[model samples]
Target: MADLGVKTPDVMTRVSEFMPEIITYIQTIIDNGFAYESNGSVYFAVSEFHEHPKHCYCKLVPSGMSNAELLAEGEGVLSGAADFVSEKRKPNDFALWKKSKEGEPSWNSPWGEGRPGWHIECSVMASDVFRRLGDPEGGMDIHSGGVDLKFPHHDNEMAQAEAESGSGQWVNYFGFKMSKSLKNFITIQGALEQNSARQIRLCFLLHKYNEPMDYGDSTMTHAITTESTFNTFFQNVKAVLRDAHQDDSAKWEGAETELGNAIDATKGRCHAALCDDFDTPAVMAELQKLIGSVNKYLETKAAKQEKPVVFVVKHAATYMTEIFKAFGLIGNGPEIGFPLGGAEGGAGKEETLTPVLDAVLEFRSAIREAARSKNFGDILSLCDKFRDDDLPELGVQLEDKAGSKGVWKLADPAELKRLKEQEAAEKARKAAEKAAAAAEKARKEAEAGIPPIDFMKALKLDDGNTPKYTAFGDDGIPTHGNVGEAPGEELNKNQKKKAAKEFAGQQKKYDKFVAKK
Candidate 1:
């Protein structure tokens, strides 16, 4: 049992499951009209509650927020109510309680027998837990969740509890979004999937908390490359320490001092940068400064002794560990989760690459025999070309000029070591960065406000050009308006060529996607 890492539920968390009184709080919210009942579900009337009006005071509605966006904000076309289909409200308004129909997971409720909503469960659960924890009258000090929870889940939780328990206060700090099931997402995950864990953590930490980040993959690679640049300095420090024992104590001592100062300066700048907004990138920029320091320290060690160098290495390790912990990063090397087996993130293509590696090995064996015979020119020539060309095609990173950092295989010792370091660094860096970013984000939002600026009043745009039409009717999958043609319009030769080209590309990409069928 101890090895299983099991833990019993806390009293507060378990309380809601047994309590009907707590359920009543959400029901009361429905009665008060802050929420409404649907067939059997409940939804919050989010438009009724005033937003932090200043949310829009800084062009926060999103730059170039289109009619499509406004349409997105409103439940206009997307909703299916026989009545109440007006665009008077916004999209940010979310359901508080979603009543379930038959076979859709329900709980018998006061509003004519339906299930409680996704949000209601949370509020009811929170209240029950708070009460069990002996803080029923006042709200919790913190109620945390992934950043995505804010708009609806947490917001609704705040609304329902305040309405019922007379406690409007809720979560104090909101953390940055995480990347557990990330490949399925669009933004930062795309960026993160390609980076060394260390780089990702550093970049994430650089950003202020709670602020949106337009995460990208290329930037993360840049970070990985930047950090690797400092390793030479580490080697230098090691050499100095090795030499110190044979030297004069005072002369050797300065080597330690130089290394210490370099690490301290990097650590301080990195820490301060993070303190502002969990700005990992800022910290990274600061940390990169140590690359030069490391090289300089190495150069000094040639003239200096070893003790100071050892001091630098030891202290730097501690500093690195702390930053790694804070930023959620530890690294062995750079290796992205390149899809292995089959289609879209399934597996790898070992079938083709495996035999090639074997073939290369056989050739290399002959080459080694030649080397033993002292075939200098031939051995050297073949070895050089072989090193460049003989790598496993399964995950060869031919584009990386500095050299491939190896694949994400858990087999080889060197590979495993690299993965452990990178993934650990990644985890630590993310957590630290999240904290820093969240704090800075809140401050920025609280302080940065430009007075409302005027804009040109454009004429009301209408999407009425299309005749009233029912779309994708009876077809669960949309027809792309017209599979081969644009409804009434005929396809031109150019359009047909382009469409054919696109279809072929998709077919090629998706067909061999999943590995081994």
Candidate 2:
């Protein structure tokens, strides 16, 4: 959770620690006529709770009451046992405390020596914490769990809490869900192994919390691409700011005014989206559009050979940084952009590497200057080697631009190396294809230059009955042979016909060769 930037809760509760409170809550529910004792067990009276005028059972999902399969699953493996079923007044009634079975942990409750049910412990713990925190009524503004819990689990918690406190409603809202039993769950540690926490967070941000999501390659790829896009935008903005001239007299103009308006509009839209059910997907879309506007503004200025207004660009970037921080995409630190080390120690690592990077870049600039002045090709190549090869291994990206000293930023060394390898592989593939094409072209040109007659002369065709004398014709095919045979007169009529066909084919190829020349 810390790796994902989730903060530690102010109070963490355990069912064992809250056993006395759980017993108290169950007794209160039984006293309120919303639960009943049967065969030394306690069960929440779902039908009675539903009939009560002040409260509604299954308020979040009333249809869940009819889902016998789901209710049985929520009640757990013991629910189907004959003894367990006989202990409940109604099938819909859920256990508040179960009678201890062989090998099962037991607690001393007013009903019997048995552990608290899965649902009741949550109510007891939550209400206990709320009361300690000064909410005398012991209700919550929100309660969250897996959607599977909406049926017998959360509804039961709501029913038990409301019954115990005599409150009309226990919580303002209920949200969120996850599971493992169907072999469809990924642990946080497992997910972190494949992707950074930011990428995982972004993946969730792209979807509505209440909606179902597929956590697979395509979703993660989109998250990675989105993260890269934001990183590139930040790098560009930082590059612009690096060279920006601080002028207090600089006023908002055409592009600046347009970008400023976009930033404000995006902020308003983001807030509205977040407020409307914490719609982060909409917020992300607005942010993407805002970044697009900023890119356009920068591109327009670059095209006109004018510098972007620093304050205006900074205003846009600062707002983006603020939103990113709010989302925990950016951490609480002096870092202005997404840290290259990801959620884990990225800012500190970047800060430590900055001095070393500056020194290397300064030395590289000097070498490059010398190479340009003295026209030292090897020296310039080496400088490029340092930028493209060496620095990336150290988690730095150096991008060259026309009329600039080039821009550098921190990045994942491994990712940069992989991309560099891909680039090199692509480059090698193109070069190989180009070389093969050139070789093919040269071969065709050489073949075209050789006359069909010369090609035939180069071949040693020795049939004893054929003529020995040779003569030329305008066409590359031989009209007279060394043996002085007219076409194929030295052989039979079939041979003559075959020879004529061969001559015709050769003559057609010679004509094509002539056309090319």
Candidate 3:
């Protein structure tokens, strides 16, 4: 949760801390004839609770089925394997306390040295939350979990809690059951690997909570695209507002009324959507519409000359900021910047690379321009070379998307290392395969009495400018080397001179080393 930037919420409760309260809950239910003890194990009497005029079974389930049918459905069991215990008097009855097995941790309770049952622990913990916070009489306003708990688990908690405390409608449960087997569930860690927190939040908000929703590729992709679009719009608004002068006196006629109407309508729609069961998507839709209207309004009104228009647009930014804050999406950072990579997840060192990345991008932007005019494919190749072979070593990943300039982000260091190792192994395998193929081809040509071809010419690697040097073995096989050039390049005028100078310097060092030897 912290990795996803989820805040430590207030009023957090742990079941372990409320073990004594759990015991007390069981005792109250047993004394009230709502539960029973059999074979040193305590069970909640579902039949008794149903028979009582004031009590009923599983309000959340709301099925007209018999107790046996519901029990067969496995409502309260943690897994399919936890069947009805032999000591249970009724099939619908659930354990409140179980006899501690050998090596299992045990707590001394009125029933004996046993651990509290899963269902009872939540009831006691919920009660403890209310008790410590001064709301024990009614319990918390809401208790939420997946829809699977509607049967035995949540129903049992409701029965135990209400039976013990004499409260009604202790929690208003929300959310539908999502089946993991159906592949509708994605863990936070898995989702975060490919998306930002804001994108995930928006994805959830877009779907209705009561309906089953699949967290698949399409849903997340839409969220990512939408998040990027929203960020672009936000950055544009900031740029406009920063330069536009603010003046209350310099007014544009009817501008105030038009802008005021838009703002009021937006606020009303936002408020209405929130009131209707906290429909975040609806609120977002309203905000998106307002953003569009503000942008269109800006196009017509000159903010510099008509300062009043800028004043109105400032309200628009302010309103949007407030809405953003409400959803906990406001502080995107100091300014609009390149997205950070995953390796910076728990580390707060992303800022240290900001200037470095900016410089890289600036240099690459210039290189791209030079490549475009001069037809220097090598420059583009160098960019890709850096992206694939060099930048990854520093935990950076550069990606090019259709219809937009490329974006770069930090990659996880471990992932980068794994990828680099795999690439190296693949390159090594390919090189060996190429060499073997070449040697076989050379042997075939020599057998046929064909003259040995220049190795670089055979490889289609000999550009006109760079000179190639070769030495022949006694067997007439060529040992090849290139001078004044590198792979994938034909040196230009200035480059040739520099290459010549460097080659001369290296030749002098080599001759001295041979002389010393």
Which sections of candidate 3 miss by over 4 Å?
64-86, 209-211, 245-250, 302-308, 332-517
Where's the lowest-lDDT run of ten residues in candidate 2?
A: 482-491
Instruction: Give stretches of model 2 more than 4 Å off.
Output: 76-80, 178-184, 247-249, 340-385, 402-405, 412-517
**What TM-score do all the candidates reach, one by one?**
0.50, 0.72, 0.64
Q: Go through the candidates in order and give each one's C-alpha lDDT.
A: 0.49, 0.78, 0.67
lDDT of 1 by residue, 416-476 (tens): 3344466678789898999899999876443323111100011111453432111321322
Tell me the TM-score of model 2. 0.72
- Which is better, 1 or 3, measured by lDDT? 3
Ranking by lDDT: 2, 3, 1
Candidate 3 or 2, higher TM-score: 2
Model 2 / residue 388 / CA error / Å = 3.5
TM-score of candidate 1 versus the correct structure, residues matched by position: 0.50
Which structure is stronger by TM-score: 1 or 2?
A: 2
**Which candidate order results from sorting by TM-score in descending order?**
2, 3, 1
